[model samples]
Target: MNEIIRLQVALETDAEQIRNMMVEIERDETDRWYDNDERPFIPGYDSINMQKYHMWDKKYYKIMYDDILAGVLLISYTGREHARVDRFYIEPTFQNKGIGSKVITLIEGMYPMVRLWTLDTIQKSIRNHKFYEKNGYEKIGEDEDERYYCKTISEPIKEINRFNSDEDFSNQNFIQCNMQNVDIYDVNMRDSGFTNMNLESGIYQNSNLSNTRFTNVNMSNAVLGDSNMNKIEICHVSLADAYIHDTNLGFEEQKAPLIMERCELRSSRIVDSNLQDLSICNCNIEGMKIDGILVSDLINIYKSSLKTEINKM
Candidate 1:
């Protein structure tokens, strides 16, 4: 009889089962990529480390088919807009039955607010690459040993974290949180409150910050690139020397005031914003518009020598 496949939070007791499965997975991977001279697996590869880190994320789950163990998954929260599918392997016995694809779909639903799902695998794992691509993920980057993949979510994020006072945040959780000078990449942070956090010198790359609050935060020297910042509210924030590129900052319904001073903007678009009383001086303005009126054309007409002749006529 076919058993129902489901995902449940894995308990510590399941470590042995997961480790045995990992051994098989490691053997398969090693066989696929390594020569006879190389070892089949890393030295000191312990099940304890796997179980420990999996529990650290608190999102590790056991993939069960009917009442039997099928596999394990370790998806961890990396940032506000991304989740990392650290490990996804089906038991060799359960392979080629469409269980992996179902697990992916389950994960997507589990975090509806996540804008991007990212993972990495051995560079030579062609089968893994194809599986991820078939499930809507695309290759983003790669290194000498691993290939990184990402899938973007188009759904609107409506999840909002409850508002809390700054006083309620403990110093251990806020001040000494050690959030500085760290790399936070590809994490889903929808509707989260970073309103009073001091994230100085942090690097937030390829992350989703939609509907996230960043009021009164000191993000000085932080790098925010290739991320989605849709509907984010940023007030009294110091973004000095911060590098922001290829990111979305405009919303369709809400009107937000964007103030730029002594900053360089190239190849970026601004729409549906309040630019009242805007002043421009000593800057190169080209190929621009406001309400379907080209500012460049208006400036040419007003500043041209022919303006006097037209006025007289």
Candidate 2:
């Protein structure tokens, strides 16, 4: 019988462990896919290449089962509109044990309206499609080769602005704080701990979130235009549907934490932040530090535009 396992998101500090897990999984899958009678033809090199890219771009979440690395799920974002599950694979030994389903459920519970892609040719893929369908995902489109398919998870809209005063809120604790639909215009939250707080659908225009902590905080559907987030320490913070424009995020002493996904910042100083799939547009970013980083299309366009302007001068 398969052992019951619990899942948790891996941290950036666990990079080496995650890499090793990826390697082992690749090797095992390669052996199975080639040796099995079905011969699915899944490329092991492709898995390795994708893992390397994810490590370089910092675009994956390590799925831990009972404190052990069981599998990996590659996450990608397209603008503020949606998040995509680019790749997901579990170990052969751990397959068909409801662990994958549990992980998907956890992700969907955390982030509603998430999207995922899968190939149609593989027989196992049909079961994958069924799994997603069982979990409230609906098919939206398919490609010609029957290889590419898209699905989305729809969820009910939750209330965004309901603060609870009964709960004790220490200066260093943001446990279960609801900042939804609340307008925090021009406030200073430096060095404060807002970890695990849900700030969905909130507006934080021209506010300072410098040196603040946001571990596992949910800021989905929030608008933070023209804000200051320099040196903020964030981790596992969901910034989906956030509108960030003209924000000042400069400084060396203050470094934002890792685990920032699906955030949109325009004309903002994003030095030394774990910026995977972050979309930026129409910004003056001369002398910016983006070395050895995988920037999104919007940021690339902004950089290209900046280069063009400089060349014209």
Candidate 3:
């Protein structure tokens, strides 16, 4: 799962690009960041007027998360000892993945000479206050509607891309990125870290796929050979259908879809799924529950009744 969060110099098309994406943001969240006068994120904001307003100079950037334009920032007076963050906003879909604080930290490295940084947010944004405070900014003053903040930097901070645990990761588009022969290992990237990742024609060996959602995707012509698919859900999609090979249905060319030997199947669940003509053999079935009844118990009761009938015969 590649999560590339980068800040690039604002381009000519960035304003319109970000505006085009604004329609995708949640309605309530859109209201939160765009309803007021000092909304901080102006859709019509452009680099030309940004430079004109910031004494004819500014450091503007567009926040890119993977292949999507997630947000933008405008820093005025970057050449001086003091700088101001004129505007900073992340799309609602891009927020809460922990991007804001990291953006603030990156700004520190962008301007090495700026000993002090300043910005203000709407007073209603308590999360913004806490976010700034968490990043070492202190509240200096506040008026009726705006809350001012400033942070001091003793030295230049180096920029690093961590995605801050809130990465716009998984199922992300990698446009024009050449990723050939990349080796990934020894990471805590489980569950949420790699959800909905595009593993098309990818190999996975000796991996534990816990809490993975394999629903509503096409996986036609996948050669499982009875690999015992557990917890995989597909909706209104029939297996082996030609249309199932597409994204909406999705798995094709099963290069060893699954092979299990001496495996543990304890506490595994299969629910609301088709198990027509399923078979099991040479496996442990102790305390195996089906519809809340133990398989062992059912077998024992059957055996007892059979013995009694044989004696009568």
**Each model's lDDT:** 0.68, 0.54, 0.58
The number of clashing residue pairs in model 3 is 8
Q: In candidate 1, what residue range of length 10 has the lowest lDDT sum?
A: 163-172
Clash list (residue pairs), candidate 2? 160-180, 231-254
What's the alpha carbon RMSD for model 2? 16.4
Summing lDDT over every window of 10 consecutive residues in candidate 3, give the lowest-scoring window: 241-250
Cα lDDT tens digits for candidate 3, 1-313: 2577888876554545655554444344446655654344443343333323322233667788886778778776522456678778788778887778778778777767677788888777788888989989999999977899988786534552222334455655445454333332222334532223333433332234445545443344322211223344434444332211101112345422223346555667665444454566788998788889998899899999999999999
Query: Per-residue lDDT of 205-269 in model 2, one digit per residue for the tens?
Result: 44677776656656676555335765455544444433333233355566443344444444445
* lDDT of predicted model 3: 0.58
- Of 2 and 3, the candidate ahead on TM-score is 3
Which is the better candidate, 1 or 2, if ranked by TM-score? 1
**lDDT of candidate model 2 versus the reference:** 0.54
- Return the top candidate by TM-score: 1
Misplaced by over 4 Å in model 3 are 22-30, 33-58, 156-313
Index of the highest-lDDT prediction: 1
Tell me the lDDT of candidate 1.
Answer: 0.68
What are the clashing pairs of model 3? 97-166, 217-249, 217-250, 218-249, 218-250, 218-251, 219-250, 219-251
Q: Point out the higher-scoring one by lDDT: 1 or 3.
A: 1
